[model samples]
Target: MQLIDSRYIMASPEVVWAALLNPEVLKDCVPGCESMTGSAEDGFEAVVAQKVGPVSARFTGLVKLSDLDIGKGLTISGEGKGGPAGYAKGGAKVTLEPIEGGTRLSYEVEANVGGKIAQLGSRIIDSFAKKMADTFFERFQTAVEGPAEAEEGTDETQKKGWFKRLIS
Candidate 1:
């Protein structure tokens, strides 16, 4: 599978870069992430529990960053095992560009999987991948924006609930 996309973050490149490299931020944003550790210089380890259709697995992987240009770009590669579920390996090249009052982040990622997970079907895996990416970005956006603005921009249905509480 391959994914290529970009997002505009409401922060400076430095702030966005700092959040990207922070394990705590990633752990909070990554879907199904049970744990993540290490650093950009020493490589990072992650454990994630993911499910697709009727198949579920716990993946443990190590990711390394290379050719880093500090607050600009980097190359990432990693592989993970899902025990009896399967194994996956992937790489990505990410670039950050300063845009307007914020930062634009882009990445091109390619990955392959094998074992029982592969047998489940590519469509399922592809959908899961897209969903995971969406969830990650949404969480990252919320984290950077903070909770006050998040609540202010809540959907109408959600706003009604909060309005009732405020009035009560």
Candidate 2:
């Protein structure tokens, strides 16, 4: 599958970048994440338990950050095995742009899956993936923006633009 999207975060690029590289922040934001360890410079290992439809699996994975440009952008690639459930490998290209009062983050991702999980069909898998992505971004936004801060005004503008593009 391929995914492309963008979000405006109510923080500076530097702050968002720092949060992105922080293992604790990732562990907190990633759905079903049980543990995350290792360094940002040397690829991290993750254990996550996830359930989709009637299937459940525990995935152990290693994620590497490459083609990094610090606060600007990076490439994230990972592979995981879920025993009888399946195996997945994916990569995403992430870019950060400084906006008026915050940062705009964009991503293009490609993923592939196989084994029992692949038997679930594309629609089910895609829907589940979308939900997971939504949850991940929501948590990430909360982590970077914090609870005490005001909601970002840019979010509405961007949403409207996206809707317009979708309808057009």
Candidate 3:
């Protein structure tokens, strides 16, 4: 499946980029993330638990970022194994463009799934995927956008993962 979407952040592009690469922020924003170990340099090993239709499973995966351009965005790719549930892998291209009030963050992801989950059909999988993406972006926007202003010049806008699409 392929998904593309965009959101406007209230913070500067630099702030958004930092949050995107931050494992802590990702762990909190990711839907089912349990733990993330590693950094942007070596990639992160993570565990995420999720439920799809009648299947619920814990997925272990590795996420890595490449082709990074500071204060912009990068390409993310990863794979996950969910035992009998299934396996998923995918890549995404994210870009940040400066807008009038903030940054326009856009992403395009293409993912492939196999095993029991894939057998459920694309319609089901696609619907679930879209929902997951919507939730993620909504939370991300809340985190980085802060309120109406940055108090004391501190942006507290509150903000997840590479294989997220794979699981959905």
TM-score top scorer: 2
lDDT of each: 0.77, 0.80, 0.78
**Top candidate when judged by lDDT against the true structure:** 2
Please estimate how well model 3 matches the true structure, expressed as its whole-model Cα lDDT.
0.78
Candidate 3 global TM-score: 0.84
Ranking by lDDT: 2, 3, 1
Worst 10 residues of 3 by lDDT: 158-167
Tens-digit lDDT track of model 1 for 87-117: 8788778788999977898888787888888
Candidate 2 lDDT, 1-168, residue by residue in tens: 888898888677887788778788788877999999988899999998998778899999998989989899998888989999998788778899999978998888777788988899998888777766667767877777654423477434332222122223
Q: How many Å off is the CA of 150 in candidate 3?
A: 14
* Of 1 and 2, the candidate ranking higher by lDDT: 2
Question: In candidate 3, what are the lDDT values of residues 30-130, reduced to their tens digit?
Answer: 68989988999999888988888887888899989998998888987878899999987877788999998778999887878888989889988888777
lDDT of 2 at 62: 98
Error of 1 at 13 (Å): 0.6
